[model samples]
Target: MNRWPLWAVLTPGEPARLERRVRAALMLEGDEEHGKGPSFEVIPGRGRYHAIVGADSSDVGAEFQIAKDLSREVDEPVYAIDRGNDPWAVTSWRKGVLEVLEVDPESLAESLGCLLPGRELPSDSSSKRPLRKVALVEGIRAQEASRALEDAGDPFPPGHYRFEDTPQGLRVSSETGDVGFADITLSERLPDVMAYGVIASPNLDMFFVNVLRGGECIGHFALPPRDDSFVPAVRDIKGENSPERILAALGIPAEWFRNE
Candidate 1:
């Protein structure tokens, strides 16, 4: 199994502010609402929900209990995350797999109260991994994506990127096209982007970019599972510069870029 880096975000009293910050960081575009659910927002985009969970020992049970209790109220299942840092780094999305749950250390500490033996959870805010030039490939299987780009050729196909896959589906992530274990199958609605599926397992899927255009995802339909068909259904050789521009515009976070 691939090791994932755990990340953290501050728990907010108001859900609205939390949501806004998540969208900005993750750059997600969805209409789903958190409402009164026990949800936390990630950075880049604000509309998505990446629930926090437990980090230390004995807290895991309590965190699961919290998720179970909140699941009844929220729209989806709750998750866990290590509460070691203020803005902790977590494997929220790895290509094909989607991280549905995260653990909240602070909440568990407060709930534990005097039960915990050590000093109250430390008050610290820092990043374990710096951001980098992360390319958000809408579709592409991780291994094949990596293989395709092994030597002289680009890692992704024409319009897709390497992604991670989990039992639930695709794990959300931002990494090199080859390293990520993403599902390759995708549904695109862009103008000149050509995306395709590389793997389709019972629980896991992989997809990648076959052709990209204008630096932007061929169209607004790059997210996923869209029903609409692309107009021309072809990739334009001239639009190769678009993906790079997108990365530059996104200002790849430190963590996404790998050293070698």
Candidate 2:
């Protein structure tokens, strides 16, 4: 797994202010409501970008989590530099609602928590496998009804960026559009809306679905289940070689498959 470096910088702005914001986010400096998440600094050419440079930066999430809140509140675009020091993911929350979250594969495969603050990622976060660049999904607005982008985090797909909109759902492609494509959808809508994802690694690959209905999940489950190291079943939630229900739940549609 690609470990996160310490001292992430988030920005496209002045260094002093960015520093103060970073410090405050770590609870090491400021007292603003938007002062807590991870860290990253800006680099030229890659505007709205940040970078990290340490290994044991546990509070590393501070840069993103704290800045996310700020983005929502301030209705500005927040940037998080990948540990790879390439392009930072941009999360723009307009009026407390997500406008867009553009990420990269390196960020997702490295760690979903890298993009989503305070979320538990499997040990597979370190997997060296490549993820599908494009994913087709249903059960939510494609690009907030403008472009097709969602801030959903499930590893890979760069938060569903620059995707083409489909009538049934959204078609989120990768930043480069060269890797491959995967279809991800949510059928039930839990209560109102929910987003599902597929996590893939070289060794273990499975669908990571969070049946969020009014902000809660259904019973988590697993199939062909593992006696040891199994998740809560889907909420416990994990699967092995069996995901028919999951596929259906993911809104993959009955006709998409051949055998059924």
Candidate 3:
């Protein structure tokens, strides 16, 4: 199992949003053919987020060493691929370097040594699996509902979703969006909200940033704070009044804007 660290490039107030943005960017940038899943973990007193791949609890020390080494070049939250079959890859939210590593004990030693600069890899059998499964209905419902809103519009059409209000819990699934490219699934809520963010799609660009409950942005992207910057997109400033004007101000193409 391998673990990689991601250093977020934003302030503390918006870790959740920033984490989502970084995850979204990875989705947008990664090769769909690879079938890679993005999984993350949060650590306190660590200035950045960690993206562990094929990692087990035993590998935390080694993972931290590798992350320390990566800190020199990776100055932002990045997706690090650590499958034994593929060379590790890291992106700093730019067209920057795309590193490839040969899967060998020496390479692992070198990366850790270089990144941690004389640190040691953790030695424990527990470094077996880092990915976990979530089991919750309301949490799952919220994710599905959010995705549904992203697919069509806010307050998703009645028939569009699957909602079961049983004594057990609430469950929701959308027929249209679930089968399309706008696919998103929810397992359970992440207790570490401090390290997560809300998901938003670029299509929300039309609403001029007005996000209604049950609605979310298309695709996910990290939302880190950096020098008070703004994208100037439709979402920057939007409300009930003159929402259309905000869209117009963004110069959204006619094809991209839809009332529904």
Best candidate (score: lDDT): 2
Model 3 regions lying over 4 Å from their true place: 1-54, 58-77, 80-132, 137-166, 170-260
Q: Please report the TM-score between candidate 1 and the true structure.
A: 0.21
lDDT of each: 0.30, 0.36, 0.28
Q: Which ten residues in a row have the lowest lDDT in candidate 2?
A: 178-187
The list of candidate 1 runs beyond 4 A from truth reads 1-18, 23-193, 197-201, 204-212, 218-260
Ranking by lDDT: 2, 1, 3
Question: How do the residues 219-252 of candidate 2 rate in per-residue lDDT, one tens digit apiece?
Answer: 2332323221111234332242345554543334
> What is the overall TM-score of model 2 with all chains considered together?
0.36
Any runs in candidate 2 off by more than 4 Å, and if so which? Answer: 1-66, 72-77, 81-88, 93-126, 133-192, 205-207, 210-260
lDDT of 3 by residue, 143-213 (tens): 54455345433323346554454333343334331211111122212221111111112233212121211
lDDT measured at residue 251 in model 1 versus the true structure, 0 to 100: 35
The CA root-mean-square deviation of candidate 2, after full C-alpha superposition on the true structure, stands at: 11.7
